[model samples]
Target: MLSQFKTPLLLLSSLALCACSAVTQLSSTQSDATITIKEGKHSGNPRSETLKTTSFGNYEFKVEQPQGKVLYGVLPLKFNGGYLAADILFFAPAAFFNLREVYPYYEFDTEKGVVRYKNKPQDSWLEYAPLAAESERAKAYFNAKP
Candidate 1:
């Protein structure tokens, strides 16, 4: 009797454990600005992305303004205790997966070419120095055109 339900229960538990994901919400002051994930399985606007927690690593992304200014950033994978506990109690394979500790919301500053997160003022995830000169050049070029 118990044996008949054991396999089904195991399969169900395994499926549930492997479905771990993290949600990242993105926004910008300029509605025309575009957000793109350069690395990992994500692409298109960063407005909202469901990242697979099982794949652990950095998710590099960029924000591009209409004038061609691009701001690069990285979203790293983080550990989730709840997922770990569930993995330990149910599926052992899921223990190896990692979760992304993303800010609930991200706002892109088009003018300053910066990406800011909610509640975190001092810390910025964007790589500002490398692209600063390029952005300036782009702005200058666009301004000169008209």
Candidate 2:
């Protein structure tokens, strides 16, 4: 009876671990394969609650790793769809930075533009400057169906 209980608990823990999203950037070895970032708005519905510019640099991505919650983190998506946050922090998870200006959490997809930040899943931001450049093998990371 005890063994049966242990097995169920272990399985539950494993499932929970897999459910969490991994916030990672490309390393040279795998750079050519993880094309989460790209140039221009080809398909993704990039959005903004307060602003939009003639260029894409003025936008950021609120990437939620887990599906059912408010954004727990922010990701900067620059012009040509290059990931500015990954560029800015160089894949440094926001938890370490403790940046107030960069509101650790955000929900641009909500009915109210601005709300108290919450750690739901994923959130992102954007800014102008010398942002991170797309990796040499950045193109390989896309889900190519075409």
True-structure lDDT of candidate 1: 0.59
Q: Give the TM-score of candidate 2.
A: 0.22
Using lDDT as the measure, the top candidate is 1
Question: Candidate 2: minimum summed lDDT over ten consecutive residues — where?
Answer: 26-35
Quote each prediction's TM-score: 0.58, 0.22
Tens digits of lDDT, candidate 1, 1-146: 99999998998776675555556677766777777653334334546776666545554556677798766655434456766676677767866665345554567665775666653445645423325554454445434543
- Candidate 2's error at 65, in angstroms? 25
The clash count of every prediction, one per candidate, is 0, 10
Output candidate 2 Cα RMSD. Answer: 16.5
| Overall local distance difference test of candidate 2 | 0.28
Clash pairs, candidate 1, are none
Global lDDT scores for all candidate models? 0.59, 0.28
lDDT digits (tens) for residues 1-146 of candidate 2: 78878987787566434322222221111111211223223222232122222222222322222333322112332232223343244333522322222222322332222223333335433222222232112222232424
